[model samples]
Target: MVHTKLKYTPYFSISSFTFIMIRLMLLVCVLVSFAAAIPWLSPAYWLSPRAWPCPEDAAIAPCTCYADDDLNLFMDCQNLDSFQQLVDIFQVDFPFKKFGRLQISNSDLRDTLTAAVFPDGFMFREVIMFSNNFLDVDPDTFLPSKTELTFMEFSDPTPNFPLPAELTQLPELREAVLSVNCSEIPAWASDSLVTLTIRCLQDTEFPSPLNLSHLSALHLHHTNLLGVPVNSFVGSPGLQTLSLNNDQLASFDDGALSFTALHQLDISSNALTTMPQLTCGCEIQWLLGEDDATMPLIGIQNVTLVCDDGSGKFDDIRNVLDQLC
Candidate 1:
């Protein structure tokens, strides 16, 4: 039997196996590199552009994109036109956790946003919607179950025809600034509002059961108010600052404000002939009244009388207000 010696070239076999292992390792490295480059490889990787894509477009010029983690501070989203665009950029799906800040000011948006657009427990801290021409706003549009919003601003140049009742449901809101028509104030506002500023209120009479017990400041500037009940500020235990400057107010119901926490009061440049005897006590610091020499200093620290004195000293009402501030 001739035993054919098969060529047992162990060296070549070992070299071949080593080459295959090296190739496999190199292939894995290349795959990982490609996977890492995918995010930067395409400009389309980011969401599409709408009315306002970048923060810069939203009047927050020189906008900076925040990471998912930095949500403790306030988020400014002023002047962003398209609400849908914001939802895409934030990657906010239903049942969202928490969002930092959102600003949608001076936009043409007229509809209310739904909870489905936000994450669960939609924790939105600050929201500003100023100068939007929204005729109507649904209260439920901002209500996120179990979420607590701190600050909200809705200052529109256009009149808000009527606001929904759902706004009263947001008990977690702390500070709010609403400069719209008097008709928009929901009946429940006095109950839930803590700090409120209502400018240009056209109504002649105040709402019943004024539940501003927790209100700190009340701004009713540039309104057509003729008279306010003396007990208007009765239940407002935390009332600190009150401004009724530049109004057509003729009289304030005697003892109209019994605010215990009353600190600053401004009723300057009004049609008021006699200043309401404010029993605001020594807590009153600043007093602004019409420019009349008969202006009595009722324990008020600084008083700016806006009278029709021929000296033109009282003509600068706005400058006086600024200096007081």
Candidate 2:
């Protein structure tokens, strides 16, 4: 009889174990990707704002609400034929009252926009109204969203266009763009406001001084402003960019540019015979015009500058000003 001895063999070596783990990890990654690619397969989809049901189409006929990429909901209404249609749209019961944005454009809707246009307790972060003829915008129209509204824009050529007085009550408001025929910028009282743009449809004036504490950028175009009044921007200590383009500015009032943080002053397409005095110690860029063109492309153009002091278009603004700092 011969004794037979058998050698023990392990089910898996160290390398084999590592390989199995790698394969398992790859399978998990693939499964996760598949789940993410298919909205119905992911838990996030169930938790997203998209999961929230929107109102029926018939209920909000002219307007539509959908979730944005950031998961916030946007309500867009375009080509509204009449203000009654707007009234009918808001009269519907919305399952979701909190919206990220509200846009209304290219419509015959006119006259006053009262609080009735927006349902009570409804909140919006942004509001845009363009190409409409709203002669009177009631101050309480945006009262419900005073705390949540961050951005607002309104456009149209309405003489004596009334800016909403409730704008000053909005604590979270940041940017406002008004393209109307107003005489002056109101004394905006928002501490959170950062940018303001007024595209005057007619000649405008700065009858009052700006008193914003946190404003950084301001653009005034087609205002036909004759000159910057004294203390025009005295309260905006943090203002950095000031653009007064397509106006009739011939000179700046004494100490108009006294702010310390002004970095860019664009006075192009104006009637300036001489450079506006620069008081800021920081280096400033004075935009003169678009090179080889009568007008500048919106947000895209080659800016050209000519030093009035005979420095010959120097890159350093100090050279143009002949001030050594």
Find the candidate with the highest TM-score and give its number.
2
Candidate 2 worst ten-residue window by lDDT:
289-298
Q: For model 1, where is the 10-residue window of minimal lDDT?
A: 279-288
Model 1 clash pairs are: 77-103, 95-119, 95-120, 96-119, 96-120, 190-211, 230-256, 290-306, 291-306, 291-307
Taking all chains together, each candidate's TM-score versus the true structure is: 0.58, 0.69
Give one digit per residue, the lDDT tens place, for model 2 in 45-100: 56765434466666787778888677788889988888888888988777678899
Error of 1 at 257 (Å): 2.4
Pairs of residues clashing in candidate 2:
none
Residues 110-217 of candidate 1: C-alpha lDDT, one tens digit per residue = 655555555455566677777656555545556663256767777754445223455556766777777765543443454556777666556545654466667887
Cα error of candidate 1 at position 72, Å = 4.0
Q: By lDDT, who's the top model here?
A: 2
What TM-score does structure 2 among the candidates reach? 0.69
Clashes of each: 10, 0
